[model samples]
Target: MKHYYGVKVANKIARVMVSSPERSGGQNQYIETPTIEKPSDERSAKLVDLILENITDTYTLESVAEYCMMSVRSFSRNFKSSNAISFNAWLINVRLNYSLELLESTSLTVSEISERAGFHSEQIYRKHFIKKYDIPPKAWQKIFKSPNHN
Candidate 1:
């Protein structure tokens, strides 16, 4: 069974691939089992869940580490091992995803959405959004609303 985790810290799904032996053997005559790491243990997983639930709040490595009762160094290493991205990168993607959700579902303006999404400014949001998606928020909205319009 394949499990998909919406790793909030990374703002991406961590998919655990479980392929049949036949397929794996066909793909590679000599196959190596890929190693996968889970972001947090049971205790840390709970902390991660809490942080994800309160993503709208101000969050930092120190804050989350304190919440998990771990040192910054240990937390940072574990977080990277599990999520495969730095904390800041994950947070930005999360905020951007949140902003996109708001843009698609709400009538809020860019500034308002940026503020609510914890983005520093509208300009920053636009820059990153365009960089990631190759389209501005406004254009994305139009395209989402009218799928056939091109």
Candidate 2:
């Protein structure tokens, strides 16, 4: 039923969507961002938006650092200080959460959802999913998608 990225659900959930135009496919990346009381500062807030905006692209710390007009060390320190999470970890969480929503809400194939969630491949996505949730995505989807789930 959601036509676009950044769909908000009831109970205060929201998504922040950013398009990655540099990539050829240029899929929108979404972060199921929770409400934030405040950011550390203006620059930090700006950086978070920038990073989340480009979430689906292949970005190295050095590349993101240069793109942001910052040195690698500065970007790392500032990003860590503000978000309290490393960029890679946050990105993975975002992609996984997005994939979960897709699984529960759509009839998309596992591979399709995995790629849409910006994973390199289904195998890699499965690995991460199993590691994080202790179950494969398909099984998780089955349980949640079933009518009897409670």
- Candidate with the greatest TM-score versus the true structure: 2
Best by lDDT: 2
Each prediction's whole-model lDDT (CA): 0.62, 0.65
Compose the digit string of candidate 2's lDDT tens values, residues 52-103.
5665667678876776678989888877787777767766876787787777
What TM-score, to 2 decimals, does candidate 2 have?
Answer: 0.66
For candidate 2, list the clashing residue pairs, or say none.
none
Model 2 error, position 75 (Å) = 1.2
State the TM-score for model 1: 0.64
How far is 77's C-alpha from truth in model 1 (Å)?
0.9
Local error of candidate 1 at 112, Å? 1.4
